[model samples]
Target chain A: MNFALTSFRKDLSRWRQDLMQTAIWFAIPLTVGGLITMLMSGDGAQPHGVLLIADQDESFLSVLIAGAYSAGDIGELISVEKTTVEEGTERVNAGEASGLLIIPAGFGDAFLDAEPVTLTLKTNPAQTILPGIITDVTEIVLDAGFYAHQLFGEEINTIQSLVDESNDAAVAAIAVAIQNKIEVVAPQLFPPVINVEIVGPPATDVQVSLALLYLPGIIMMAVMFSSNGLASDFWVERDHGTLRRLVYSPGQLGSFVIGKALAAAVVIAIIGGLTLVLGFLYHGVSWAKFPSSLVWVALSGVALFSWFAALQMLFSNQNTASVISSMLLFPLLMAGGSFFPLAVLPGWIAAIGRLSPNGFVVDKLTSEITEVGAWIIDVNSWLIVAAAAASGLSICAWRLRSGFAQA
Target chain B: MLKVDELTKNYGDLVAVDQISFEAGKGTVFGLLGPNGAGKSTAINCISGLLRPTSGHASVAGHDVVSDGKAARQNLGVVPQELALYEDLPAIENLRYWGKAYGLRGAELDSRVSEVLDTIGLVDRAKDLPKEFSGGMKRRLNFGCGIVHKPPVILLDEPTVGVDPQSRARLFDMVEAARDAGACVLYTTHYMEEAERLCDSLAIIDNGKLIAKGTVNELRAKLSARDVLQLNGTFPLDETRQAVDTLIERDDLDLEVITQEEECVTLTLSRASQHLPDIFAVISNAGGVVTETILRSPNLETLFLLLTGKELRE
Candidate 1:
C-alpha cells in the first residue's frame, strides 16, 4: 500500500483495460497522417514524357538535328516514333508517350529564303506541373537551331562563289574570310542558360529519409507529453484516500517516484514506437535505416519522459496539467523543429530551439539521415540530448522529493 | 487505542480547536458531538494527521500522529463527510484503487477489496460507478473505502449525515462492526440521536471547547437532582392557576415552569419524581385538577441543555 509500485501496477491495469482504445487512438492518427502526407506529396506514379521536333528539310541537317536530342533529359523531349497525327493519337492513348511532332518537306526551303517558321508542341493534361517546363525548354532549343542554320547557309554560299571565281584569299586571307563568316553566323542568344550537371545520384530518395527521421522523432515528443498527463495517477489516489494510507504506510517515497517515472517511460516508448512504425507502413516508407532510427527514437522518448515528469508534478490537478502541458508543448514543439524545418526559422527562434529536447532529437535524426557531413558523428546533438535528459531527471527527482517532504 | 491529548489548533486570528482532549478505546465508539463551527472537523483532521496541531499531540496505538505519521496512519482510516471518491471509476475499481494505495496488491489486494465491498452490502453493485449509486449506496462506498485496509483506528466524520434511513442504519451497522473488529472509533455528528444510538461515550463541544464528556447515562446523571413533570387536565382557566403559581414562587423551592395553551403544564423541579404526589395534591386542591400526571427521567438532551444552555441541534 505504501509503495508507488502499487500505483504503477494500477496504472498498467487501467491502461490494459483501455488497450484497444489506446491502440485505436494511435492507429487512426498515424494512418490518417501518413495518407495525408502521401496525397500532399503529389502523385508519384510514373514519369510520362511528350517529344516534339520540327525538322524543316529532308537533308543531312534534319538527320543531324534528329541525332542531337537522342538521350536522357533531351531524348524524352521529343516523340520521334510517332510522326503522323494518327500515330501521335494512338501513342498518347496507349500511355506510351505524351505527344508527336512533324515537319513539312518544304520547311528547309522556306527557312533558306528567310521565311518565318514556327513549331508545335502537345502535352499531357493529367501530368500537371512538369509538362510546362518541358515545353518551354523545347521552344528555346529549336529557335537557337533555326538561327544557326540561317547563319551557316550564308557562309557556305559566299565560299562557293569565291572558289569558282579563283579569288585569292591567302592563307591569311582564307583565315580572315572564315573568321568573318563565323563571327556573323554563331547563335546570337546566350539564352540565360542553366546547365545542370548531375555529379552523383540525385537525392530523390528523400521520402524515406524524411519519414525515418521525422516520424519517430515527432511522435516520440508527442507521446512523452501525453504520458505525463496520464502518469499523474496520484490524482486518482488522493481522491481514494489511498494516498493518505500510503503516506502513513511503510513505503519509500523515492521508490514510488521512480516507479511512476519508469512506468511512464515504458508506456510512452511502446505507444510512440507503435505509432511511428505503423505510420511508416502506411506511408510505404522503407525501413532499411530502422536500426539507426530506433536508437534516436528511444533516446528521444526517454528524454521526453523525463521532462514530462517534472512538468506533471508542477500541476495539482488534470486541468492544471493540461494548461501547463500546452504551455510547454507548443513552445517545445516550435523550438524543437517539429512543425517546420529548423533552418527556416529566424535566428532568435533557432536560438530558442537550442534549449528544446525536440530540437536536439530532430537535429540528430536529420544528421543521421541527411548526412550533413558533421565533423563528428553528431556530437553536439548527442550532447544536447544528454543534457536535456539529465536536467529533466534532476528536476523531476527534486520536485518529487520536495513533494514528499512537504506532504 | 486512539488518544488525543490536549490537542490545540490556531488559525491566525481564530482558535479552531482550543485545547480539547479525548480517547477512544478498542471496540468502543466515542462521539464528538457538536454543532457546526464547533471544531469537530478540525479536531478530526488533526487526529488523522491531515492537519498539524498548533500545540499538544495526537497518537494512534502509541505512534505520534506527526512524528510517526506513516505508522500512525497505517492504523488509521478516515471517512470524511464529503464522499471522497472517484465518480468516473466503478465502485469496485474505486475500492481496488484505495486498496492499492493501502499497499495491497495482486491477489491479496483483490480479496481485501471484495471483502470491503461485501461489508458495505455493495457487492451486487461493485461494478457500477459511484455517480450512478443512490445517496445511500454512495455513502456505503465512502465507508468501504476507508475501512478497506482494516486499520485499527477509524475516524468517521458525520458518515450518516446525508444518507437515507436504510443506508443510515447500514452505516451504523458498519460502524459497530468496525468497533467489534477492535477499531477505536472517533465518530462525530451534529445529530444527537445518531450519537445516542451509536456512541459508547460522547463529548459535547461548544465554540471549540469540550463542554461535557462522559457516557450517555453518566452525563444524564449530572441532572439527577432535577425532574421534568408534565401535567394535563382542565384548569380553572383563571384564579386557580394564579394561586398555584403564587404558592410555587417561594425561594426555598427551585422550579421552572412553562404552560401550553393553559391545558398542559410542564414543570422542572429540582427534586425527584417521589415528590410528584405532593405536587399533584396541591394542583387538585387549587381546582386545577390533573387528568394525567407523569414524571419523566432526565436524559442526555436535558444534560446538554443544563451544561451549554442550548440544545444539541441548536
Candidate 2:
C-alpha cells in the first residue's frame, strides 16, 4: 500500500508536469459544453428577436390582439413595433426583424361576426428559432380569440354596434345592460369560491434552465475526456519502458495499476469540481448538491477510466488504442446524453442510454439537481458505480499480472 | 550471495534458458556472456523474479525468488538493457521513486538518492529531466536507479551496450565500487573484452545452453595450443573449398576452418607462423585473393570460436 501511494504521487507529479495535455483535456469539454448550452437555451430564458406589428384594423379588437404580444413575459422575448404595411414589409425584407405581423382592416369586424379571416404573419427565412416562436405565439392568440367569441358573442356584438354608430349614449346603454346581467348571474356563476394561498416561506424554487437540464451531460463529457487522458498513460509508460522497470522492483504490479487508477481519479475530480462550479454559477445548478455531485461524478470517472485502462492493455500501440478509444468515446457520449439530452431522445433510445455507464451517472446527477435530498440517500446508484469500478479494476489487475504491458 | 540452480525457462515449444546454474558470493563480479537470443535475459529475468523458472530455483541473498519474491526482490537491483527512467522526471526524482520502490524511506531514501546521484556523476544535473540529458547522462541515471537502495545482488544486463567510452569507464568504476562494498554483481554482455576485464568468473551461453564457464584465464587456456588466422577479401566458394581441401591434404599443416563468408575466411592453426607460407601458396594457387591477414593469440575470442565454431556476434 505504501508503494502504491508512492507510485500514485509520482504519477500525479508527472501529470502535473504535462501542462499542455492537461489544459487541452480540460478545455475540450468546457468549451463544447458551453457552446452547446448557449445554442440550445431558448427565448424563454432571454430576449430573442424583433417583431414588427402592422395594425391596419384600427379597431378595439385589433388593438386587443396587438396588446397580447406587447405586454407581460412574452413581451420580453419579442420587441413589438407598430408600423404601416409598407414599412413592415420593408423591415422584414431588409432583415431588420425576425418577423412581421399584419392585421387587415376588416379583421376586427370578421372576428366579432364570427367570420373566417386570415391574419398574415411573415417570418424571415434566415431566422429559425425566433421566427418560429413568433408564428407559434400568433397561433395561440388566434385560438384565444375564437374562444372569446364563443363565450361572449352577444356582449361583443353590442360593443361592435356602439362603435359602428359612433355614439357615446349607445355605449353607455350597452354598458348598463352588461352591468345588470352580471348583477343577476354573479351569485350563480361560482357557487363555491376556492381561494389558493401560498403557505410556504416564499418558495425559492428556481425553474430548471435548459442549460441546467443539459449540465449533467456536459459533466459526463468532461469525465469522459479525463478518462481518455488517463487511459493513454498506460501506453505512454509502457513505450517509455518505465513500466517494465517498475515490475522488477519490490512493488507488486497490482500496486502499480492501482496507483495509476488513483492518479486518474484525482485528475477526474479536479475536472469535475471545476465544471460543477461553472454549472452552479452560470446554469443555476443547485449549490447545495455541488459537492456531493462532484464526488459522485468523479467516482463514475474512475470506473470509466478503469474500464478504458483495461481496454488499453489489450492494445499494443498508443496511437491505435487512442483512435479506437475515441471512436468508442463519441458513441458513448451520444447515446449517454452527453451530446443530446436523454429527455429529448425517443423512448427506447433514452431507455438504452439510461442503462449506459455514463448515462446512469448523468441520470443520478440530474435527479440530485432537480429532486431535493435524493443524492444524499441514493444508495443503489452509488453501489452500481462501485461495482463498475471493482469489475474494471479487477480486469486491469488480472491483465497486469498476465504481462499485458510487456513489449 | 546470488545463486541460480539449473534455471530453465520455456516459451511454448521454444526453450529459452536450459538448466543454467551459477553462483556468485559477495564482493565478486560474475559475467554471463552470450550473443543475442542466447537466453541471457531469460536467465536474468528468472533470477530477478520477473519470470518463473520451469525446473530450477534462484535466490538473492538466500531468499528464494519464487517462494519469497518480495524479500528476494528487495535484495536485488536490476539495470535492464533499455533506458527505463522517466524522461519527464528529473534525475533526483527518478532516483527517489526507485529508491522508495526498493523499500527505502525517509532520511535514508533521501540520503541514498543523493549518494546515487553523486556516484553516477550527475549531481550537478540532478534537477534536469532525462530527456534534456545527453545519452551518456541518461545511461548513468538508468544505472543509478538500480543501485539507489544498495541491494546486495545487482544484475547489470548489457549496461554498457550503447554508451560512450567515457560513460562505459565510469560504469566500470561504479561496478568495482559496488563489489568493493560487498555486493554480488551479475553482469551480462557479449563484449568479450568487457568480460575479460571486469568479470572474475564468466559463463558463455549459446542457443539456450551454457557452452563454457570458468575464470577468464581458465577459459582462454582451452585454446592455448592453437592460433587463429583471419583472411579478408573476395573468395569464390568453390575455390575456397578447393584451397581448404588442398591445405588439409598436406601432412605438415593442421588447419580447421572456423567460419567462411563471401569476403572473409577464418581458420584455427596449430602453429600459424610455421604454416603460413604453405597456406598462402594454397590460397594463391586456388585463385583466392587475401587483402588483409590477422594472426591472433589465445584469448576469449579464440576460445569462443573454438567452442561454438562461430563468431561471438554471428
Candidate 3:
C-alpha cells in the first residue's frame, strides 16, 4: 500500500460513507442549473387567456375584427371565442377571459356610412399581461379599419352599393381601385419614410436552449463546489488529529495530499460525466466528445481544488479558510459563466470570464464539445487542463509539506 | 529505544518545551506527568518528529528527529489526545490506513491490523464506524489505529483524557501489552494513579520545564516516605504556618508545610500518623481547633506537589 494509493482508497471510502454530503455537493449546482434552465426554457413565457367577441353586428367587417385575435402570433397567446354580449360580460367578470370586445348592432353600417361607431372593450383587472395584450390587439384592429376607410372610403362605399354576386365587373373595378390605393401607401409601409434603427444584443441564429446555454457554466459550478468541498477535507484531517499522526508517519505528506486529490478527481469526474451525459441526452452536448470532456473536467476540478487546499492551508483557522474560499468561490462562479454563459454575458464580464480558469474550461468545453450539429475538435484542450492541474497540485503539495501537517 | 536530550520548542517568546531530557529503554514505559498545558505533548511531538525542536535534539532508535525525520518517524506511533480515528472510516479501515501510512502492506498490513484490533478488543466491531461507537470504543479504536503497524516507539498523548473507567482499564492493558512486546512507550498524562500503575519512570513537568525525573519509587523517596497530614478546622492561616515552622525548628522534624489556610492546614512530615497528637496539640496551642484529619502516604503526586509547591491537579 503506497501512501498515495492508500490515501486514495481511504478518501474514496470516506466519500462513499458520506453519500449524503456527496449528493448535496452534486445536487446544489444541479438544482441551480435546473432552475436557470427552467427560466430560459420558458423564454417567450406568454400568458394564456381567452378574448371573447360579442359580434352583435355579424357583419363581414365585424367578423374580420374578431378574426384578428385568432390569427398568427397573437392567436397563440389569446384565444378568440364568439359569444353574446351578456355571455362575454359574464366571462370577463368571472376573470375566466382576459377581455370582452363588443361590436354593437349596425356598427359596420355606421362605419361604412361615415357615422361615429363606438367599439367597447372591457378587460379583466385580475390579470396584467393577458388583458394588456387583448386591449393592444383590439386597438390595432380598430385603427387599421379606420385607416382603411379613410384611404379607400369611396371605393368601399361604391362596392357596398353594387351588392350583386354576378357583378364581376364592379368587383374587379373595386379590387383594382383598392390595389392602387395600397400601392400609394406601399412606399411608406415597406421602407418607412423615417427609418428607426433598433439596436440590441447581437443575436445568435443558433437556437441554443437555455439548458445548453447554462450547462457549461453549471458544470463548472459543480466542479467549483466539488473543489471547495475537497479543499475543506484538508482541515478535516487536521482537526481530527490524523494530520498530526501523519506527521509521525514515514509517508510524505505531499504524496498523501496528491493521493487524496486523486480520489477527489474521481468524484468530480463522475459528476462531470453524469452532467455531460445529461447534456448529451437533452442539452445537445456532443456524445462523441464525452470522454475528453470528462478528462478535462477532472483536471479542471483538481486544479481548482489544489488552489483551494493551498489557500486553506495558509489560514490558521478552519472557519476562516472556509469563509475565504467561499468568498472566492462565488466571484469565480459569477465571472466564469456559471451563473450565465459567456456568450450571453456583457462584453467586459465575458472577457474576464474567458480569461478566468473556470471560464476557460467552460469556453473550451463549449467550442470543442458543442452540440452534434456544431461540434469541433481541438486536441490542445488536454494540455491546458493538464498544465493547470500540474501547477496547482504542485503548489498544494509544496504547501502541505512545508508546514501544514507539522502546524 | 527513545531518547530526548535538552529538546526545546519555542513559540516565539514562549518556550513550549524547555530543555526537557529523558530516555526510555525497550520494554519500559517512561511517563511524562504534568497537568494540562505543561508541554507533555510538545516533548512527545518533538521526539516523534511531529514538531521541530528549537534547541537540542531527540532521537528514535538512534535516528535524529530533525535530520533523519522519516527514519525517526518510521519507528514511531502516536496516539494523540484527541480521538484521531476518522468518524466516517470504519475501525478496520482506520487501522489499515494508518498501518499503510507506516509503510505496512499486503499480508503484513492485514495481519497486523487484526492483531492490533484484538489487542484493543475491537475485533468483533471492526467494520463499525467510530462515530457510532461508545466513547470507550472510539478510544480503543484510536489506540488500535496507532499500534496497527507496531512501531518500535509509541507516544500516547493523554489517550485516557475523557475515557470511561472500563475503556481506561482496556487502554492500560494495551499499553502493557505493547511494552511487553519490547516497545519503548512514552506515556504522558496528568493522572497520578495511571503514572504509578503503568510508568516504570516519570518526568514531572510544569510550565514547559522538567521539574523532576526518575523512577516512581526514586521520586517518592525524594518525599522521604512522608505522610501528608491534612487538618480540617478553623486555623489562623499565619499562626498555622508559624506553628508548623516553630514545631519543625524545635523538634528538628522532617515536616514541610504544603499549604496553610483558615479552614485547613496541610503538612508533609515523616510518621505523620504517629505525630498526629503532637501536630494537634501544636495547632490547638496556636489557637486552632482540629475537627478532622487525613493522612496520605508519599506517592508521585505528593512528590510532584512538594517539588513544584503546586498541586499536581493544577
Candidate 4:
C-alpha cells in the first residue's frame, strides 16, 4: 500500500508535468459543451419562433385561431404577428418568420357549419425545426376547431350572430342556452362511469435550459478523454522501462495497479470539479447539487479509466492499444449522448444508450443537477455505477496480478 | 549471494535459456557475456524474478525466485537494459519512488535517495529531470534507481551499452564499490573488455547455452597453446585453401584455418612467431599476395570467436 501511494504520487507529478495533455483533456469537453450550448440557445433569452397570422376571414373564429398561438406554453414558444396576405407572404419568403398562417375569407362560416375548408400554412424553407413546430401547432388548432363545430354546431351558430352583432339581450339568451347545453353534456365529456386519474407526482413546470441538457454529456466526454490519458500512462511506463523495473520491487503488483487507479481517480475528480464549477458559473448549473454530481462524474471517470487500463494490460503494443481505445471511444461517446442530447435520439437508441455506463452515470449526474435531492434519493443509479466501477477495477487488478502488463 | 541452477526458459518451441547454471558469492562480479539474441537477458530476468524459469531454479540471498518471489525480490536489484527512469520526473523523485518500492520510507528513504544520487554523481543535478540531463547522466540515474535499496544481489544488464567513457568509468567504480561493500553482482554485456575488467568469473553464452565459464585467465588458458595469425589483402579462395592445406601438412608448423574471406585468411597456429616465415612462404608459393600480416595474442574476443565462430558483438 505504501508503494502504491508512492507510485500514485509519482504518476501525479508526471501528469502535472505534461501540461499540454492535461489542458487538452479538460478543454475538449468545455469547448464542445460551450459550442453546443451556444448553438442550441438560439438568438434570444427565450427560444421562440416568429409566426405571421393573416386573418382574411376577419371573423371571431379567425381571431381565436390567432389567439391560440399567442397564449399558454405554446405562446411562449411562438411570437404571433398579424399581417396582410401580401405582408405574410413577403415575411415568410424573406425568412423573417418561421411560418405564415393564412385563414381564407370563408374559413369561419365553413368551419362553424362543419364544412371542409383548408387553412394554408406556408413555412420558411430556411428554418427546419421552428417551422415544423409552427406547422404542428397550426394543425392542432384546426383539429380543435373541427371538433368544437362537430360537438356543438347549433349552440355555436346561435352564439355566432349574437357575437357578431354585439347585442346585449341576444348575447345573454345565447349564453343561457349554451350553459344549459354544457350542463347536459359536461358529464358525458368527463365520463362518470370511467374516471382517468394521473397517479405519478404532479407535473412541475421546470425550465430546463439547453446548457443543463448538454452539460452532463459534455462532462462525460471530459471524463472519457481524461481516463484515456490516464490509462495511456501504463503503456508510457512500460515504454520507459519503469514498469519492468517496478516488477522487481518487493511491492505487490496489485499495489501498483491500485496506485495507478488512485492517481487516475484524483485527476478525474479535479477535471469533474472544474467542469462542474464552470457549469455552475457560466451555464446556470445548480450550485447546491455540485458536490453530489461531481462525485458521480468522478466515479464515472474512474470506471472508464479502469476499463481502459485493463485493455492496456491485455495488449502488448501501446500503439495498438491506443488505436483500439480511440476507436472504441468515439462510439461510446456517440451512443452515450456526448455528441448530442439523448432526448433527440430515437427511442430505441436512447434506451440502449441509457444502459451504457457513461450514459447511466451521465443520466444520474444530469438528474442530480436538474432535480434537487435526486442523487441522494436515487439508489438504483448509484448501485449501477458502483457495480460498473467495481467490475472494471476487478478486471484491472486480475490482469495486473497476472503480470500481463509488465512487458 | 545469487545462484542459478540449470535455469531454462522456453517460449513454445524456442528455448530462450537452456539449463544455464552459475553462482556469484558476496563481493564478486559475475559477468554473463553474449552477443545479441543470446540468453543473457533471459538468465538475468529469471534470477531477478522477472521471469519464471521452465525447468530450473534461481535464488537471491537463499530465497527462491518463484516460490519466495517477494522475499527474493527484496534481496535483488535490477538495472534493465532500457533506461527505466521516468523522464518527466526529477532524479531524486525517481530514486524516492524506487526506494519506497523497496520498502524504505520517511527519513531512511530520503537518506538513501541522497546517498544514491551522490554515488551516481548526480547530487548537484538531482532536481533536474532525465530529459534535461545528458545521456551519461541519465544512464547513471538509471543505475542509481536500481541500487537505491542497496540490495545484496544486483543484476546489471548492459548498463553501459551507450555510455560515454567517463560515465562508464564512474559506473565501473560504483560497481566495484558495491562488490567491495558485499553485494553479489550479476552483470551482462556485449563488450568483452568490460567483462574482462569487471567480472571475477565469466560465463560465455551462445544459442541459449553456456559454452564457457571461468575466470578471465582460466578461459584464456584454453587458447594458451595457440595464437591467431591473419594475412590481409586480395587472396584467391582456391590458393588460400591450398596454402592452408600445405601448412597443415608441414611437420614444423601446427596450423589450422580459422576463417577464409575474399580479402583475408586467418589461421590459428602453435608457436606462431617461430612458424611465421614458413606460413607466409606457403601463401606466397600458392600465388596469394599478403599486403599485411598480423599475429594476435589470446583474449576474450579471440576466445569468443574460437568458441562460437562469431564476434561477441555480432
The most accurate candidate by DockQ is 4
10 residues in a row with least lDDT, candidate 2 chain A: A200-209
Task: Show model 3 residue runs off by greater than 4 Å.
Answer: A42-162, A165-207, A327-336, A339-345, A349-407, B230-246, B249-268, B288-292
- What CAPRI-style quality would you assign to candidate 1? acceptable
- Residue A100, candidate 2: alpha-carbon lDDT: 90
Tens-digit per-residue lDDT, B60-158, candidate 1: 988999899878877788898777776666889878867766667789888889889889999899888787889999889988988888888899998
* Candidate 4 per-residue C-alpha lDDT over A198-294 given as tens digits, one digit per residue, 9 for 90 to 100: 6965342334776568888998999999998799888888788887887888756777877888889899999888988987777665466777887
Find the 10 residues in a row with the least total lDDT in model 3 chain A: A368-377
**Model 2 chain B: worst 10 consecutive residues (lDDT sum):** B246-255
Alpha-carbon TM-score of each model against the true structure: 0.71, 0.85, 0.84, 0.81
* Off by more than 4 A, model 1: A19-32, A39-71, A74-106, A113-135, A146-208, A231-245, A248-252, A279-320, A341-351, A365-407, B84-118, B122-138, B222-314
Worst 10 contiguous positions by lDDT, candidate 3 chain B: B250-259
Per-residue lDDT for A1-407 in model 2, tens only?
88789889989988888878877777888998889877877565564789998988889998898888877888888888889889999989998999999999899888887888989999999889889888888899998888667756787888776665777887777678778876777787657788888686433344566677788898899899889878878888888878778778875677887788889889999988888898878866567887788789888999999899888778877788898999999999999998888878899999999999898888888777766643553788889898898889889878766786555
Query: Which 10-residue window in model 4 chain B sums to the lowest lDDT?
Result: B250-259
DockQ of each: 0.24, 0.68, 0.65, 0.72
RMSD of each: 8.3, 4.9, 4.5, 5.6
- Model 3 CA lDDT for position A155: 85
Comparing 2 and 4 on TM-score, the stronger one = 2
Predicted structure with the largest lDDT when compared to the true one: 2
Clashing pairs in 3: none
lDDT of 2 by residue, B1-314 (tens): 99888889999999999988888999999999988889999899888877888889999999999999888988999998889989988889999999988788999998998889889999999998899998888889999999999999999999998899999999999999999999999999999999898999999999999899989878977775689998898788888888897777766656778887778888887789888888888887877898999898878878887788777877
Candidate 3 structure quality by residue, lDDT tens digits, B1-314: 89889889999999999998999899999999998899998888778776778999999998998998888888888888887878999889999988888788899988998898889888899998888999999988988888888888999999898899999999999999999999999999999999999999989999999999999888888987788877898998777778888877856468788777898777888887777778788899989998988778888877877777667887
* Per-model lDDT: 0.68, 0.86, 0.85, 0.85
